[model samples]
Target: MRHIQRIHINVKSFICPNCAKSFKDNDTLQTHIKYIHECERNFCCRECEKTFVSSSDLNRHTQMVHMNLRRFLCSTCGKTFHTSSNAKRHFDEVCGKKEKKNGNS
Candidate 1:
């Protein structure tokens, strides 16, 4: 016969005072406060003068639209896409085998 012991631990959560939103971590709650509650748009695009909350978003926008960087390439058709989601959508809707619905092929 074997004996087993179980232990319970409590996790501390960070809560937003303004909207009463709760997060498991403090950094995520701080980021949400800075971006959503503060409405900060510090990052700006040089090409179109658009603003963004973060630098990564600005860089992605510039690469996708201005620099025309299509990093996601489809293996079946060799087609390029700006984002991975777009490439996956193309593969699922066009290249991959799909099931027919309501007698429509």
Candidate 2:
């Protein structure tokens, strides 16, 4: 209820002192401060030694880049992409012609 009131109502109460950016909640503001302002990346990728602000980001990087997991396949072009947005972009932007269907990667 609080989230809906804050986010849906566009009431950004928490303002970042450094950049003057507003956020819906304190946790988001803290996360933005920790990652953007302080540049404190805690989640490290063992595969590439790259660091990220959150564990989800590290997991995404590992799965997409290191694992080569192309799960989002373009229905029209039959091309595989690492993410759903990428596949949707292909379908929207360039996947007009039906390319030879490759089995799911």
Q: Top lDDT: which candidate number?
A: 2
lDDT (Cα, tens digit) per residue for candidate 1, span 55-98? 99999999999999999998877999999999999978876643
Tens digit of per-residue lDDT, candidate 2, span 1-105: 896878689888899999999998899999999879998789999987999988999998999999998999987658999989988888766664333233322
Q: Would you estimate the TM-scores of all the predictions?
A: 0.60, 0.61
Clashing residue pairs in candidate 2, if any? none
Model 2 clashing-pair count = 0
The residue ranges of model 1 lying beyond 4 angstroms of the native Cα positions read 1-33, 98-105
Q: Model 2: how large is the Cα RMSD against the reference?
A: 6.1
Ten contiguous residues minimizing lDDT sum, candidate 2? 96-105
Error of 2 at 13 (Å): 4.9
- Report the Cα lDDT for residue 14, model 1: 72
Model 2 residue 8 lDDT? 82
